[model samples]
Target: MASRGVGAALAIAAAGLLAASALGKGWISAGSASVGLMGGEVCRGGKCKTLELPEKDGWRTTGTVAFAAALGAAGLGLVAGIMGLARKRSKVPAVLTLVAALAALGGGIAFILVAPGKGVMEHLAWGAYCGVGGGVFAVVGAILLMRAAGAGPSYAVGMPGTANPAARTLMLAETAKVSGPEAKTMAPGMAMAPQVQAPRPSKGAPAMVPPCPKCHGPLQFAGQFNAWYCPRCQSYLQV
Candidate 1:
């Protein structure tokens, strides 16, 4: 599961993509001359040229490339967020987040380096700054998510015992029980036998009688005489 901090960071980074897209358009001022850059209308001497993504130049323009990268990063962020929240966690989310951050970062850099304006004094617009900021935040969030994924349940190290002390103890105890004296003391020739107890009589059941004294045969009880007698012996039994 993605930590709350990491999730929040990814969300913020995704927002950066929007910011970057919006900020990548603006004018650069040079003395008295102002020129529009990437994704904006360039004005020089009252003449204007509009540039947009997938420009008429067949997507080869610097503006298109930079914006594309930013878009890619934003898409990756969404995917990473979904994967991070999956029931079964995996490294995919972390990888996706990292790729997203890198894409955004690269896009921002490209936007500055490949900006479509020629001016003696060029000033970047707020949108460019937002893109850069969002990229930075995304990178930070990705790193955190990766660390969290790898750490797993053992995130907290150097604690009193261990991260999952109860589980460890249960495992150890089970191992000990299996390897202890009762398991090891069995003889080669003799097998371990389960203990069998005599059946107990019910509360209202008659009591049992001893076998015959002479023949050790089954005995019969006489209710009227209030005495027990042996059938095979057929003799008066002593009280």
Candidate 2:
């Protein structure tokens, strides 16, 4: 639960950062021509021109890709957060959250690499800082969520549709072992031990005890006591 809460916060933060990065100016250009994320404007002899990102400029492609990636990360983070809330023990959501974080991180790196460095100088904007911060937060949240997934109860505990009948049978077999030991007797100064075969469910017969309705833990049938027992809840179940 705690991990889920943290994950939610981080995901929200990531979304905020990604939004800012997408809307704000992530790069700036100077010299004969000035180009920034918002737009590009022409300049001459250090005179400033209108701000716009022109389609003809090749560098704009890199910025566009990075922005797209950031947007994708933000969207994925929201999805992961929702999954984390609904399925705390599920690892799939955590993996997705990690992927989202990596996307933002990768995008930021790409933007840095492709940023203008020649006649058109580039400056890191607020969007870059926010994006980096958001990516870090996302990574931390994903790690926490993954750790929680491992510590939670089995996912199949309450979902009987996915439960394995063979596993339940094995569990019952192990439980039967603790009922009582084999009977032994000594006769004429000699000790004799009789072999006993564990009882098995008759072919096509229904199970002795079904899974607990609440916890889904294996149930034990106590023939001698004439009652079905749930080891998980330590309560006798109605026949």
- Colliding pairs, model 2: 39-51, 39-52, 39-53, 40-51, 40-52, 40-53, 41-50
Question: For this target, which candidate reaches the highest lDDT against the unseen true structure?
Answer: 2
Tens digit of lDDT per residue, candidate 1, span 118-156?
Answer: 542247655655667666666666666666555534423
Clash count (model 2, backbone only): 7
Q: Model 1 off-target regions past 4 Å?
A: 1-4, 16-24, 27-38, 42-49, 52-60, 82-88, 116-122, 153-239
CA lDDT of each candidate? 0.52, 0.60
TM-score of every prediction relative to native: 0.49, 0.52
For candidate 2, the TM-score is 0.52
Clashing pairs in 1: 23-127
Best by TM-score: 2
